[model samples]
Target: MAGYATRVKADIARWREAGLIDPATAEALTRDVAANERASLSFGSILAMMAALLFGAAILIFVAANWEAIPRLARVVALFAVIAAGYVGGAVMKTRDHAAIGEALWIVAAAAFGGSIALIGQIYHLSGDEASALVTWCAGAALAAVALRSNPLTVAAVGIADAWLFLKGFDFFGRAEFLHFFIVMAIVLFAVSFWTRSQASRHLIILSVLFYLVLLVGDYDTLRIAVPLLIGSALLFAAAVFAGDPIDRILQLGGRLPLHALLGFLTGIAMIQFELADESTYASGFAVASIVALSGIVAAIMLAGRESRGLRWLAYAGFAFELAIIYSVTLQSMLDTAGFFLAAALLLGILALVIIRVEKRMRAAAHTGAAA
Candidate 1:
């Protein structure tokens, strides 16, 4: 708040000078600036959180120390007591408007629920699928997150739930391990993202969806994993590229899927590695490999790297690596190495020239439109 105060004040003064908003409206908006002055957590709140976490850990240690001496019923009572105390403390803090403490307590309660699940499962000698315990634990945490509107709890729940679903995806190869459950979790994560408007939750949900797409290859032959992933990423990239009123008018879905840009960018890089790693052969194996490498580099540079510098550099690296592989494997003469570098330099020069021309045309068009 202190850092941004001058800029905030300047912006408010500009708005006032421009007569974009009334004085009362400006004051109304600046109320949040006043709140920001107190946004830093006080020492007492920070100390309280640390002590609470240490105390919880101490109780867990005590449980392990006296596991045999404590009766089974007493052990259960103690576990539930910890949960009850956390929630009660959180509620009290919430009522008193010390939301930092309340949020921390909610996180503690949610974490303790995981321990309770494991302990209860062990105590009852639960014989059915071990996945049920994880799923149940996830559901409990998600319920708490939704009910309390806690962003941290929501993110934790999504992560834990995805872990459980991923385990299932690996454990069961048949239709039983289909990604439907992960899909459901993605939907739930999206709802939580919208409800809480947390950017972290949205990113987590997108990562889950990306991972789910990767998981789809578990059932396929090991040789062809990249095909579907690249296709899916291309679809996402296309959707993001063509977003807005036209697509919405046709599909009745509003707004862009901004996450697609990042997901597609990363998937493009992954596809390059997988395509290079594949040792499979075809009729024209060398030609096929060359085309795949070239296409991957071009696609990444032109589309995926349009917004991300990392992806652009990764594409350049991939192109150089492809040349190294070709030189080391197919043509291993000093002359061949020299030729490879020359060819690479020429290719890059051509690409740069094309891009420069395109940028110049775009700028000229922008100027023309402004004049019109």
Candidate 2:
């Protein structure tokens, strides 16, 4: 939004100079953009948020250190008091128009709610796993995010949701049942992100889902999972390319939907390649994966690179990663690898030429359409 505001302001200046818009109209437009654009967090706000977190951590540590000496009733009262103070203080700050500081305080209060849940449960000798406790904590954070309409709180809630999923076990494999719960929580967080306009939270949720997909393939290591992932990722990438605006409208993620979809597509390709390598067809499988990854990168550059620098950079990173993996996988056969790279390079060179021609035609067509 900050970037958008800057661009709009620049355009307004250009229009004023060209006499397309009067100076008065341009000034009004600039003021409107400034009024409506989402403000970025200042350095002070960042420090305040960090300070709140540190203070909350210190209070929690102090209380825990003297837990046995403190009366149980006093402990409960103290925890509730902390939570109330944070919320009430945040409300006051918000009323005074210190929104960033208010949101930071709200985050502190939400963190305190989670801590209180854990501390109270421990004090009462409640029976439950860490995952269950995290689930409760996540629920509290999520509720706070929705009620306060705080992007920072929404991000915190998303992090708690991820933490809940991670608490399942160290195995990082097949928890099909828990994955269902994780998906539900992710959906809730994603929806809350829309309400809070938290693009960061949405990114976290999507990345978490991608991580879960990786885990699924890692655990299953079969065609059933790998094939579906590949097909699904491809379809998703296609939709992101062709229907990006609609997806943006629905997801409200600006221009990042396609970038994320490209990542998921590459991940699916990697998953399939791993399956093939495990099946003892390493050379052929790795070659196919390289081609697919290279093609995806090229397509992204040709299709969306003009609009999204992030997407282009992600493609570049994917290309480097693909090269590194291929080199490592073929380390034992360096001679064969040399020849293979020559052949692959020639193939890709030809593909690049075709893509260049196609992109030129695409630009010409777009220019013609705009002129019309």
Candidate 3:
């Protein structure tokens, strides 16, 4: 028995020396491990669980009891009481290492309940404008998340607040100024996410960028210099694809599809203008071919990369735009138009077959690698 005890002690000593445990913590852990091996439950863990249950029940009872006549002061007091109870329960659970009962979950639930109570008060005639009421509710939620270190709820509150601001601003002013306000708000959210490490906030930023891109494209006809504007927009999309990660790649690629369609429409306009300006037929043909060739090359490169599904759609869009250009340049003569359509159909069919073959080979390689 003495020899067995000495061996166990030596093993523990080595663990401490290896920095797997701090000396003080190791002593406590060793005692806990021994107790656990004997199938014991710690008092602190039981107490923390009981506290959480009690507080949760208290919140329910308080709301139910005062559902009709809950005074403003009482609501505020209840909110603070819930927040304090949550912190204490969290601290107790942390000390006992009862991580299964998540602190963040309790905190967020409590905050949501408190916010609902406050919102109810507002609905019943506790004074505030729609903006102020929304801001207050979101602010309370944000505070709870920060206090409890809950990233998910913090992000949710941020998103709600941003949407509220955008809607209110648009309703008051109009769509024209809302675009600028949304961009500013998106930048602020992105900055906040960097510090908070909130994935939800990052997603909201992506959505904001997409919304702005759509707004810009819808208003493209307002621009006086259409060709230069189209080129700049295309360049911005290309830059976004190169500079952004996968998510940005998807957004930019989708945004660029509509731009391509717009390009085809604009191409018809340019043709009419050039014809009126007395441009030579050769010069016009060269210009049209150059635009089609450039767009097709870009699309092919994007499709080959296969980083996004949107890129594939954009590739198809480019092909459609190119066909439209070909039709316009040849529409004056029927035989030439038919020939151009036939050539395009053949090219698309071949491209589709090549893509399928490449995808099949990739799948086979992946399976082989996994098996190995």
lDDT string for model 1 (149-261, tens) is 77667877887878776777777523364656777877876777556545567667776777766776566653365555556666655665565446534423223242344
Q: Tell me the whole-model lDDT of each prediction, alpha carbons only.
A: 0.66, 0.80, 0.55
Q: Give the local distance difference test score of model 1.
A: 0.66
lDDT tens per residue, model 2, 1-372: 448889999999999999999989999999999999987778998899999888778766765574888898998898888889888899899999998788778877887787787788878888876677778888888888788788888898888878766655344443445355788989888989989889999999999988777656545655666567667777877787788888888888777887888888777777766566554434576677767778778877877887899988998998888787777777777876787688879988998898889879999999999999
Backbone atom clashes (below 3 Å) for every candidate: 0, 0, 0
In the range 1-372, model 3's lDDT, one tens digit per residue, is 334345666678899999987899778866765664523335764565466556555665655555557676666665666566655665676568665355543543555455555545653666655555555656665665556555555675666666665565556534343345556655655555655556566655555554444344344542343455446545654554455456344443323443343343334334333333344433555345535554444554543335444445545565565556655656566786786567656765677788789989999999999999
Measured against the true structure, the TM-scores of the candidates, in listed sequence, are 0.69, 0.89, 0.45
Candidate 3 TM-score over all chains jointly: 0.45
Query: How close is each model in CA RMSD to the real structure?
Result: 6.0, 3.0, 14.6
| Stretches > 4 Å off in candidate 3 | 1-66, 86-127, 139-149, 169-180, 212-372
Off by over 4 Å in 2: 18-25, 169-179, 279-283, 359-372
The best candidate by TM-score is: 2
Instruction: Supply the TM-score for candidate 2.
Output: 0.89
lDDT of 2: 0.80
The residue pairs that clash in candidate 3, if any, are: none
Using lDDT as the measure, the top candidate is: 2
lDDT of 3: 0.55
